[model samples]
Target: MSSTLHAEQPGTSSRGTPDRWESQRSFDELGRPLRDITFTVVDLETTGGSAEGGSMITEIGAVKVRGGEVLGEFQTLVDPRQPIPPFIAVLTGISNAMVADAPPVESALPAFLEFAAGTVLVAHNAPFDIGFLKYFCEQQGRPWPTFEVLDTARLARRVITKDDAPNCKLSSLARAFGSTTTPNHRALSDARATVDVLHGLMERLGGLGVHTLEELQTFSGRVSTAQRRKRHLAEGLPHAPGVYLFRDHERRVLYVGTSKDLRTRVRTYFTASETRSRMGEMVGIADSVTGIECATPLEAEVRELRLIAEHKPRYNRRSRFPEKTTFIKLTREPWPRLSLVKRVLDDDADYLGPFSSRKVAEKCLAALHDTFPLRQCSDRFGKTPSRTPCVLAELGRCLAPCDGTVDHDTYAAVVRQLRDSLLHRPDRVVEQINARMEALAADERFEEAGVHRDRLAAFIRAASRTQRLSALTRCPEVVAARRGDDGRWAVHVVRHGRLAAAGVIPPGTDAHTYVASLRASAETVAGGPGPVPVATAEETEKILRWLESPGIRLVDVEGEWVCPVDGATRHLALHDAVARSRTELVPFDDRRDLTPVHQPAR
Candidate 1:
């Protein structure tokens, strides 16, 4: 996989980074009550361009609303105690004569603060108004109130297209929306017009499934104009856990994703936080958004994996081709040797891992050679041919299997030892390396020890994950359950390491009927193939994680899962205790506390 900054590596494109990753980011609850939120929409007329440019507030107007009802209003003329520029007077019509007898800004600030306390602040261009008010409040020896601010300009960019209004200016939007209250540049009239625009935008957003304050505030600035127009694609999607498909005009699937709230997740594509240019391009061509409502989040996730594999959509970057994943296999040559291969077959050879990335595989391979006496040669032998011992043999790192110095029987014994260390007893390798690291550090060979230390960490991460995946894949059948966002239980059935059946079991549903129906439906899918190959390694890892989630109950299972006990993974806790205090980091006594903890039962 190429490591391009903009393009994701293959088998990883389907997943998002921490910021936008579906599983990483928290979701809004099933039904977020948007109407109950109170908002204080404020506007200000200033004497000049900006607060930083010696401008002061000339007028203040705000309207507080909740559930579409006007809670209260605050309006006043503020004396800047300075001359109002002619350009400002012409633009806002708030001239020196109008504010000559008005109360000073000190007097108007308090009343507006009282009206806006404990509510969201919104404005056409929020920074200017908020900047003016916040500066004066501080100048008056009062603590500036912290208020969540929303910009109507940003929201307008998301909701109203340039075609609808050439620009999102207040006058343009007012004329376009046909607001009865026209903005004549006065503060109160403009604020009233903004209120109308706010209501109009909210009405449009409601149809697009955007109903929360957070959603409205960030929708416009981040999403492109083309994406905003396609909000109608999500008009009919249900607000539940499910999968969504973004399709082109030719009915080609461009992207696929799963979310607990399909409507909200799909709407997020056209919001401000979604700043990926590639996603913007995808949205430009997407003609429709389609969704499939699943009974549970687990079911939705499983469906996403299958769909990504089947479609191989252009926009999707991850899990596109599991077939390309590499495995570190011990080749069944005249002399058994470790080698990286793309596919795992029925060849009589032992396999250590089907690693996710090649970088890690190479690190583990290099570390393994350091600990075990294995031949590093590329010669394929039909019969034992006469050859000289290489440099690795001279350094005592190899047994010289290519030469007559190490006989076949003796080399075979060494290969068996290496196999034992890799498969069942990985601690033999970790403990050996740890001892060497400790020795080097004692002799002030710090740089060399650090290399071994990093190699230890790499081996542990790779081995732990490999062991967990192998444990799940070895089982014939397993059933688990986790509570859904709603008051229901989501049951997942796995057979031969693939998701066979998954459906919701409501609190009061009949247990026997649910199981029967689930099994009948699962039979159609589970019977497709016997067992997944190394190509489906990602599925095995995903299943392992799902099985480890909290509150998961084991409804049924088959076979005992054999776990590796004496590995760097299980020994990591011991290493961690001493790993702190790098200045005096001494390897503590080897301790193994990696006990198996079962998921919670219902």
Candidate 2:
């Protein structure tokens, strides 16, 4: 509450507080013109400080104006039906005698409301006046009509510096703006004074290019002419769920965004709400915005991921180079060791990932090595033994297949075990981890148990993702459809885990003709012959995502499109246990080399 009984915006702090005001009202910049706004500048003189403090308004005054011209005015003294306090009567010069002949508040309020109807409310410190009026309406059991409110105090703070105007009080602003009418606590005189203040703040806003009712409602001084010029880009977009592209002068895609309401979302770029520095830079270079309307948000999301993969737009920092996504593969060399590679080679090799990045692939690799005793050595080993065992062998992390310690047949069996663990039987992997965890816990070495628990969690996470992705990759083709806008069907054809074709089948058209046409016109995203790799991690991910979207009808599917009955994720109970143990700080962590939080028993 303020000294003048100013109520804060519903969930915000006062003017002197360090929180930005939260406001929401619908006003389109292009659709609703600001010049047509019927502004009712209002003021009130009350007997007490606060509405809730049993205060009653003595006088209500307002001026309705538009385009710098006064349309109408309202002023009235109300018989509070209660005695006015001595200080308030003295301050407002509205004594009991002055209002003796005045009508009671019950009758006067209706006339005031009629005069102020269909007008946007304006007040220097709005909450105080509005609060009093609202309380009166509530007391009379009359529902208060809602009005779009503009606080000159907030507008002044955004426009004027503290050095120019020490504060945003109506009298202070009126005097600063060189108004002839001085506020001396009389309601009509003060309301008239505030009208000048309102116009003065609007003048400041106009200089800042906030000409629309929408722009002024969300006023900011940073709106540049260049940014505002781009508002036209959003003007033609439909208010539907879809993906939007921001393209530059070269017709190169600079940024891509998805929105349920394309028009509103794209228009926000020019407003003050878009506080991201990179977004401003994106908007500065952005010449046009194009929208691709989708039937569902899931389709929009999938489309966004695919576009990000294909274009690799400069402003899109993530998934741009889906080709850069790495994979962990067991090579077909004589040694048959694991290696992280970018492209999935044509050579027959056991592959695990399509991991999001090199770091994640490396992390998964490190986690896998902690449990599996496969050959960690990178060198090719013929039918004979190569170099002696290395440090990893000494640490018992590797099977030492490079030495006679592990024979060729034995190493081959171990390689098969690792392969089975990755592709088909992660159940064995989960069992081995649980056994190790149980041993650690039985010895009362809980911290080590925690370490084991965390490693199990990481291994399961990587394994689960890799398994899911590999399943999709192995599918020869998948055709799916979702209901599109205007009663159409949005169809996607996936070949070898990449978008083969995409198009819409209109409501009245024969579906087969459009599908064939779409496939004919379809640009090859993947499965094209070239030196450069065509398919991407994101492309496969997009197909998987769309398949997983709710209400997706599977048109057709090829290959074994099913999860293994005994797949790695089957031991979901183990995953749950590991998750809980880690949370209890059975103390699972990745920082194994860091300082010991507790000294475990030897």
Candidate 3:
């Protein structure tokens, strides 16, 4: 993008002298306007490109200007709490090491706001930088200032003939404006260059109805005729699941969302009386709306989440849910057992889960012990020299670690077995059930076989309920499901032990893709070793890689575990050819009947 000005000539002005501002004649020589106005030229070095969602600014620099002269400046480094990508480090030279000790955004935003008070904000790409500022301010519950924004880039495009310019980058603009060589990508230097470019643009556009700060702010805030046209355009959207975007006249994004009924949701914003209250003010200020429609609600939700995480929309609120949800951690001690707790501790223990609630955690632990029978007593139970093997041992619930009969290895083995059961690989349980039922039937023990069959049914029910958060899928899939504002529900399908499909489900759609996505996912996970517990950062990364793989197809489906394409069979073939390969099929919940079926050759 070009700067708003063209260079006249380079001449040293006494403008930089500390005491020059005190002379009234100096102000006149500088052609200072009589109007009372303020502008702050700002720049930021961020974690990386795409300021859409979670990407953060690591450094900010601002220089305040009035009339046509520079006044003062502000600059600071911010901690983004995420690793700066390698490409960013190479370009900006703001290394991860340099920012390791920097203060977080919460500590620096107030100071930046204080410096920017009562000023029209100006930047090279004003929308990109200011959009993040607005988002940050809103998250902190601080009122967002309605400052008039000026983009030197946009202004340059208006004045400089596209073919005549060497390049529209800030560096090119600086050189064209006769600015001395300044450090590139450094926030302060870039801010200074932007100021110089703006001054030049104003001089060139002088007599052509060039807008003043007040005029620009009014234009930026008014609901323009063009915006009405765009809203009308949005009215023609289909009433199907998808993601939608709202943009200003300059095409800067204002909001992002997903809905099962796209037209209905978008229309609601235009019709709601409260639209004037929450987002209406911003929407009214917008000049146009853009959207991308998906085939399913799940697809819409997935796309919405990805966009929100990527673009960090000023008005979008769903991206913050991951940090707010709670999970349960199981300690990995020698006789390591399970406990319902919040937050993962650094103690020597393997984390079992991140459940939605304490009640869910308790239920999971109870069901697990009932099926697998690991020790539930504390370490202190056997150390006190108990007179009899604890009640749990007498009831055949535990091996009685308290009796000193079960060896440490044997006890640890049982614990591992329990862990495997909770992880949802019930092959051992299945084998045990099959063996007992067969022995009883062989002896004509029908009643015993029936009891074993019931036990096996209970085990299947328990196993099905096991929640698989990041299970790999069989195809490249996207499922879109809406939870509460803070809750996220996703189904990942793993085929041949690899992620095949994944997605978020937007609200509404109750059949088709939702069921197909689940069945495909289950087939993928069952086709492999099933879903394994992700415990460490490396494991988490592995799961993420699988989910993000290009080969994985994300689909939106409804009702748990139903086939997405053919609904005739509730059972998904876990051993299907696509699933039998290295790809594994994993499902969110066993809400659908996924029993394996054998077909006779045609």
Q: lDDT per model, in order?
A: 0.72, 0.71, 0.57
Using lDDT as the measure, the top candidate is 1
By lDDT, the candidates rank as 1, 2, 3
Error of 3 at 500 (Å): 23
- Residue 265's lDDT within candidate 1 is 90
A best-first ranking of the candidates according to their TM-score comes to 1, 2, 3
Regions of model 2 farther than 4 Å from truth: 1-229, 238-242, 247-253, 272-275, 290-303, 306-311, 437-454, 484-487, 510-534, 569-602
Model 1 off-target regions past 4 Å?
Answer: 1-221, 382-386, 436-451, 523-535, 571-602
For candidate 2, list the clashing residue pairs, or say none.
Answer: none
Residue lDDT tens for model 3, 11-127: 424434345444655554444232356789998887644355467888988889887777998988888899874334444657777788888888788898889987778888676
Candidate 1, residues 1-602, lDDT tens digits: the string is: 77745656544435535444444345743334558878888888776545765668889988898888889888999999998643345445566778999999888999899989998888887876788888888788999888988777666765565457776777777787887789876778888888888888788777665678776654433455777888788878999899999999999999999999999999877765565556777889999989999977777887887888999889887877766666667777778788887766777676666666787688788778888777778778643757888999899998887777778888888788777766666777787887876677557566677677666656666666666666666676777877765767778877766777888886788976887678668733332211245327667667777888888888778766667777436654433322321111111111111122344587
Candidate 2 at residue 474, lDDT? Answer: 67
Candidate 2, run of 10 with poorest lDDT: 585-594
Alpha-carbon lDDT of model 3 = 0.57
Q: After superposition, how far is residue 55 of candidate 1 from its true place, in Å?
A: 53
Best by TM-score: 1
